[model samples]
Each structure stands twice: as C-alpha cells, then as structure tokens.
Target: MNPIRRRPHIDYELDAGGRRSLWQTLPTLTPGLGVLRHYERRWLRLDGFAGIAVVAYMVPQVMAYTAIVNVPPVVGLWTALAACVVYAIIGGSRVLSVGPESTVALMAGAAIAPLAGGDPERAIVLSSALCLVVAGWCLLARLFRLGIIADLLSQPLLVGYLAGGAVLMVVGQLGRVTGTDVEGETIVAQLRSFFSVVGDTHLPTLAVAAGTLTLLLAIVILRPRWPGPLIAVAAATIAAVVLDLPAYGVAETGPVPVGLPLPHLPIISWADLQTLLLAGLGVAVVAYSDNTLIGRAFKPKTEPGEKSVPDVDPQQELVAMSGVHVAAGLFGGFPMSSSGSRTALAIASGARTQVYSLVAAVCIIAVLFFAGPLLEPLPSAALGAVVIYAASKLVSIPDIKRLARFRTSELVLAIVACLGTVLIGILAGVGIAIALSILEMVQRLARPHEGVLGRVEGIAGMHDVDDYDQATTLPGLVVYRYDAPLFFINVGDLRRRALLAVEKENEGDPDHPVRWFILNAEANVEIDISATDGLKALHDDLSERGIRFGLARVKQDLRTPLERAGLVELIGEDMMFPTLPVMEKAYLTWAAEQAVREQTALEHQAVPGADEPAGTPPARPVDTNESDR
Candidate 1:
C-alpha cells in the first residue's frame, strides 16, 4: 500500500509593532475617508463644479420645500447645510445628496401642524423634535440590522403616495399664489375656501405668480439642465425690489435670520415627545425608503472583471442617515430624506465623491451668512411657483399608465392612496398605503403556488405536469411540489391541494392506483409548529387511503422539526430519500419485485392451489407492504 502524503503547514505571524491597531482601521469604516485615501487631483475640479451646480439647484428648491414643512425658509437652509455635511462623512453612497425632500417635508407638516395649533414657534420646535426621534429610529434600525424593512412599502404604494402628496402640495400653495386666506384640512374644503375668497384676490400677487410660472415653465422646457428655480427666484426678487411690489399688497419673505444656526437640543413636553415618537417612525420609514431607492437607481455600474467601487451597505446607510438627521435636529431643522432630483443633478454634473456634498454645504453656509438679506425681497408667489413646479414632478403619468396596463388592481390601489392623501391627510394616506402593501403581501403568502411533478421526453428533470402536453407520470406513484414555506397561514390549504392532486391522478387511470405519494420539499425551507401538525395530519390521511407518504429533497434544517414532531418515525425513515432520481429508482426496483410475487401467486392459483387442498379456495395475493409496490 502507498503511504498518503500530507501537506506541510506554515506558520503566519507578525510582530506587535508591525501589526495595525484598531484606531488605524476605524477610519475605513467611514466611506468618505476610504474615498479620500484614493483621491485623484483631476477629480477636484469636477467635484467643485458639481458642488456648485448642486448649490444653485438646491438653494431655491429646498427653500420651496420649506413651504410644505411650514417652516421659515432659513430653516430649510439649515437643514441643507447640516444634512449634507454630516451625510458626506458618514453616508455609504458617494453621490447621494441628502437634504430636505418634498414628500418628507409634507409628511412632517402633516404631523406638526395639528399639534402646534397654528403657532409657528411651536411648529418649529415640533419639527426639530421629530427629527431627533427619526434619528433615534434610524440608529435603532442600524443596531438591529433591519435594513430589509426598506422594502416594506411596495412600489405601487409609493406611486400613489407621491401622486397624493403632489395634489396636496399644489393645493397648499394656491393660497400663497392667489394671496388669499385658504384654510382647510381637505382638498374639497381648501378649494371651497379659495373660491369663497377668489373675488378678493390681490392682483399684483397674481401677476407675479403668472410671470414666475411662465418663466419656470419656459426654462424647464427649453433649458432643462439650467438652474431654472434659482433663475426664476432671482428674477422675481429683483423685480419685487425694483417695482416695490410690497406697496401694492404683494407679500415678500421680509427678513430672514442672517448667519449660521447654533447647535442646541430642542425642548419639548413629555406628552409631545410621545406624540412625536410615532410620527418619527413613519417619517423614518419614508425617508429611508426614498434614500435606498435613489441610492440604488444611480449606483455606478461596472463590467465583469473590472475593479468595482465599494458597495453601499444597507445597515451602514441607516447609520449615516441617523447622523444626518441628528445634525438637522441639533441645528433646529426638520426630518429629511434623499432628494432624487438633487442626486440626479449631482451625478449629471460629474460629482465623483462625497466631497461635492461638502462643497455644497460650504456654499449654503455662505448663503446663510452673506446672502440672507438679498433673498429677503423674494416674492411669496415666486416661491409658490417653484413649489408647484416641484410638486408637478412628483406625479408620473407614464408610471400610472403602466400600472393600469399591467395591473388594474394595483392601479386602483395607487389612486386610492392619492385620493386618501388629498381627501384625508398626508400622514393618514401614508398609513393607508402601508396597510395596503402589507395586506397585498399577506394575500400572496396565504395562497402560494403548488404543482404536480411529471417527466417529459426531452426534459431532464421533473416539471409541472400541467405545463407540458406530453408529460407522463410513473404508474402508482405521485410526485408533488409546493412552492413556498410551509407555514400556519397556508398549511391547511397545502394538505387539501396535495390530496386533490393524488385523487385526480388515480381517477385519470383507475387501473393504476396511486400507492405512493412523494413531496418535493426543496421550497419548504421553513415549517412552523402549526405546519408540522398539519403535515402529520396529511400523512395520516394518506395512510388511511392505503398510500405510503414519503419526502424527497428534504432540507437539513427541516429534519429537526420533523424529528421533534415525531413525523419522521410516523412516515418511516427508510421512505425519506435525498433526491428524486434515487427515490424513483428504488420505487421501480420494489415494484418489479412485487410484480414477480403477484405473477407467482397467479400461476399457483391457476394450477389448482399448489400449496393448499384441491377443494379449498385458491390463496389470494396480499401486499406485504404497500410502500414496496
């Protein structure tokens, strides 16, 4: 005999001084530092230009979103500055621009307006408190590695939610543009209030609104890549100052607080804290959902064998956003999420890393300190026009039409969500959308797909019998497959469907009774306690009908539950096979042996009871074990 050759081991070691310490490795945890470690000089100019573009785009757009949050326009600047700076350091994505977004702003307003009771000061405090609570929820999610919850809200729900929010936004700005006191909680009531005061509209404000809208539409249609909102706002501000439109009863921003915001925790009552906590959870879900969606949409693509960029970790994203909202709360801003439009703008302008976000932050700081007075004369109508434009982008006619063509039910759900938001409120509409998403998921789980397995002439493995016209099944055998986890929700249904499959097969060819039933258990990776009981009942039913129950392709994890439930003993350990082919081969061998025995018994009976008295009845053939046949 030849001796076996063993591979030699080599020791791996390094001196303590040569080894890297934890502190040195800690910096890599922040994606920003990792990108900086490989920074190129050529990217500097590109990122700088991208950052400038982001500033011009965000300044007017973010200020307009503040109208949704019902906060001072300066507070929006605070949100942009703090969120962008913090996200640049801790965020997972290189190009994602985190800041005030219209949907989240609208949701924040919905939660705060009711509690503040028309006090703007109280509303600001509530907004800041809500930011802190949202930060807490994000941090909690990161700690628990619950990033998968981002998919809890379905796409159909989001479509409807955004559509609903757009209508609410346009309605909210009607009063500003018309210079009337439009006050109502619902769209119907708001329109009624607006019409009641339509006769008393301020003509100068209406004129400013018309000019601003026309300029915005023209720029958007002709020069889409241009800073349309900024241009529109600047022109209106210049006109307001030159024409003295305020004297004609046109409302202006008046005075914005100059300089940077001081970092301080917002104070609130314990009751308010409890109220804000719930609102915070909703806001966090929406923010994270949008952030993840945009982050994935613009993720840089690479070809095979190419060195790719570091992928964004979902859990790390939660941590980064937690820091972003914490910064916002400290700076007296509101809850914020990633703006898809701003992110697209940054990417389009050649942003290569988070450094662009830092540049944008610096520019916003400059605006907050040096340009606040310049914007004081900006007309409310122009801001309203900017907001209405932003809102219009939220509704996608193509998406709605696609849903209608592919899934009419989902289209209806989306419309319901929109109507719910307009008729009810932003927060409640979101609640309804989330509920609908959950219900849709439950409906799918409660009635999963199942199929009967058979063989086709050219097919290599088992396939659904219903799918193939020429598929054939083995005599006296039934192979079945259930394409979902065996849970309490649908285990009873599984039992009924499986039994019906066997009965249908037997009835199709009564001469070949189904003596063996085998389940393809590859998809049943999980089986809960109730499902185990249900499985046992199924086995008992098969046994009563003289059919032997067996399992094929059982997962390792499923063994312990089956063993604990005593199902393994009840079904017989020998009947469980590792693969379908092996099981089928063994069944064929047994069937051959049974056929031989039956033929022998028939021969003896024809020979006038070879083993019994001549006058006695011929011995009847009996099955030693039905499973063997």
Candidate 2:
C-alpha cells in the first residue's frame, strides 16, 4: 500500500466521534508542528521579513517592559524567547506574539515588591515562581474548560483598568525620566516624593528622556508602521556613546550578562508559594484575557475554502499558554502576556505562520549572546521613555467618550474600576471589576424591561404599546412580556408589573375591565421555585378579579419546573398555549361569550315586570326536557 500524505491545511484539531488514535491526536495538539510539517517555500520570505520587523520592535520594547517587572533587562529577552517559541509551537492563533506585556509586568512587580523587600535578585526569583504558579493555574483552567473566564473582564473594565495602569506606569517612571530617585509605593505618595525632589532633576537624563519620547511620539503619529521605539532607543544609544552622557550624570543600564540561562526550576519556599498564589491567579486572568483578545484581533484572514490557518480555539489557547508560561518559568523569566505592538508589527510586515516567531526567537538568542555589551551604554531614561510611550497608548480616551455617550451606567462601572485600580491596587481592581459585573447582571435581572404588548396598525405581530402611538390593544385583554428569566430576585417585579397592567386597563375603561391577562413567556426560558409560586399567586389573584389568566409561548425548560412546582396544573392546560396567536384566539372567543351574556342580562333587566305599573311584554315559555324543531 502507498503511504498516505496529509494535506497541508487539514484541520486535525477537530475530533469526530473519537475516531483518531492518540498518536494522531498528539501531533494535532501542537499546531506549530503541523505548520512545520506542511511548511511552504513561498512563505519563507514573508515570514522572514515579518520576523525582522518583530525583532526590531521587540528588542527595545520588551527591554523597556522590564522596568514594569522591576527585573534586569536581560530577563525580558528570556521571556520573549520562551513566549514566542512555546506559543508558536502550540498556540491556536498563527500570528499572536506573546512577550513581556506592560499590564502583566506591572502586576507581577507589584505582587513581588513587598516580598522581595527592594532586592532585585529576590524579585527575579519570586517573579519566576509566580510564573510557574500562573502556568499551573492555566493548565487547571484548560483541564476544566474554563476559557469563559477570559470574558469575566468586560470591555469597559478593560478600558478602565488599562487607563489606570497607564497612569500608575507614567507616574512610576517619573523618577527614572528625571533621575531624581523618587520614593513611594503608591501613586499619591510617589507624586509627593516627585514634587519634593523636583529641584534635583538631572538635566542630562531629562533631556535624553524628552528627546526619545518626542521622537517616539512623532514617529508613531507620522509613520505608525515603523519601529518607532526601536529607532528612538537606537538614536539615544548612539547619542549616549558619542557624547559620553553617563559622565554627565545620565545613568546607563550598566553591564548586562550575555547568553541565555539554563532551564531549571525556580527555587522558592512554601511560604513564598502561599503568598504568590493569589497574585499568580490574578496574573493568569489578566494574561489570558490579553492573550485571547490579541489572538482574536490578529487572527489571520484566509480566502474562502482555504484552511491555511485554523480558527482560534479558546481551550487550545489555554493549553498553549500553559506551556508558554512553563517555558518562561524554567528560563528564569517573569510572567508574560501577548504583546499588541509586536503582533501588529508582524501582521503589517506580512507574517504567514509561526515561523516568524521562530525567526524572531533565533534573532533574540543572537542578541543575548553577542549584543549584550552593546546595550551597556543604553540610557535608563531611554528605557523609561519607551515605557511611557507604550503606556500612553493604553488610555483610549475615545472609547471612554463613546461609553459615556451610549451607556452612562457602564461608564460609571468603568470609572469605578479605574478608581479602584488607582486608589487600591491592580489585584483589588480586578476583584472590583468582577464584582461590578456580577452586580450589574443581578440588577438587570431583578428589574428587566417589561411592557404591555399590542398590535400596531401596519406592523405584524406585537410590540410594546408605549413604543407606538398607533398601537391598539384588545377591548378587555392585556398581554405582558418580561424580558428576563423568572427567578426569585425578579419574580416579584413580574407580578407587580402584571398587576399594574391590569390596573391600568381598568382605570382606562371601568365599564369593561380587563377580562383576560396573558403572559408572553417566550423570553422567560427558566423558572425557579419562587417564581413558579409567584406565578400561581398571580393566577389566583386574577381569578379573584374575574380575569382569566393564560400563558403563551412557554418553553419546555420553564414548563418542566412549573409542572414540578404544581403551577402548570393550577393554571390548567386549557389556559396554556403553544403560541401567542392561539392564546389570542381563545381569549377572543371567551370575550364574545361574555359580551353575549352581558347583552342578555341587560335586555332582561330592561323588560317590564308584572308587579310594576307599566304593561308587561308577552312571556315565552320554554320546556326544560322537550326539544323544539
């Protein structure tokens, strides 16, 4: 038999009926291997160009992010190496670039600061341990299919959180930018310290920072596709070396060790592990959110019917990220997240596959080995400038304005999250964001939008009466629709609104009060015990008022619970309908019978009696047992 060759773009990730053997599944799990196995020749040049662009953008940017991590600049290269290589190997997204991200770096630094007690060496160790713990968390989340956790941090919160982090970052760098040695852990205290030392600012460092920042901003505005930060950093480095800026009080990065560190487990105590657990989890959440967001944003576009790059799988992303962090930890690097700047650069440079990341990794390894001494003259102020420039992009003023205009309540949430992050801490801010999200959800469910439905003159079906001036309702019937599930917290609101609807109808026409009240229950997909009981009470109240109660479009999910709660039987099957039109037909028939009875009673009342002075009409006798034909 001839050996079968797998297609270059076949989707081996999807398992149908568990038919594929474990050996086949194992290779599919690592998507990078698939890319390598089917590597195309035409993509080499494109990926190579993209890889060079990534290297240009990353060398300075990742090193600058180390300021946020409070680690040595060399560690950033290690993080970049591990993140890119490992993520390329198993990552679901073809173009997502993972590295030392500002937000995650800030979080890791804050988490380890107290434990490290100002010791850089201890901070590195703690950061590495934290990375391992984060890896463990990612693996656990993947094992349990908890990828939905990424969505826990909503868009508004993200905007607010990043904005607040930006403020913290900019403030934190004021010392380095000015060479004034500002001292404080909090923003407010830092500002105080900064003002106190304002007079002591080193002119050389301040000038270097100003020049670099201006160049970066100008390049970003004028030529966004260029490696602005790299250009700025290289310019500053050249200026530093030529002018001997360090002799004039400009601090340099000093001597950086060349080459990569050997892979080994991060040494830490049990106490350290206990302390880092919560921080690690926080980092994991933030990192995963960032990774997923960037991955989605940069998902490669393919022609129709082409399967060159598979769609992003959130579960697979978690597994891939777990491996990335594991690699980072073993390489003695701090926690990392997807880098938007580098990924954007790669995309703009026309990257085709994970090979670009491999190319960038190879370049990073070379830089670490040979170019470490070249970075010795790199000014600290230049690095701070790079960080400030990156942080400035995170504010997103336009998004905040949009939120303010469209959704004021959500804007309030964004503001609260921002304040919490700024006033308390990043980790606390995450907690507040989650709490606000849950609270908003509960509040919405507790008092969801509801209205009396009626038919408009030209529109089909039913809509809210208040929404249309020409909408018409049945003479003595009210149809109410609630837009959320019927639960304990919200069942009371439903009952209240239903009763109010009836009262409104009666107030509008007392002579022919509401005779039927039908609940349009299509949106009420689930019902709890309390809600079922509340519904039963509502039925009894309507019956007492001589108003018939009916339900239309009740889902089976809700009906099962209603049946279990005895509400279905209490209301009776005759009063339940599969659709709104059928229920409306039943109500119309009942209304006609009611009208006939009312007319008969009125005619009999108007007839003269024998005891009255007026003449009586001839009586017609009716036999109870005989049939008249």
lDDT of 2 at 542: 87
RMSD score of candidate 1 (Å): 4.5
The lDDT of each candidate is 0.87, 0.87
TM-score of 2: 0.90
lDDT of 2: 0.87
**TM-score of candidate 1 versus the correct structure, residues matched by position:** 0.93
Question: Residue 118 in candidate 1 has what lDDT?
Answer: 70
Question: What digit string (tens of lDDT, one per residue) describes model 2 on residues 178-230?
Answer: 99988778888989999999999999999999999999999989998888988
* Best model number under TM-score: 1
Total clashes, candidate 1? Answer: 0
User: Which sections of candidate 1 miss by over 4 Å?
Assistant: 1-29, 300-306, 603-608, 613-618, 624-629
Q: Could you tell me which 10 consecutive residues in candidate 2 have the lowest summed lDDT?
A: 620-629
Per-residue lDDT of candidate 1, residues 166-194 (tens digit): 99999989999999999876679889999
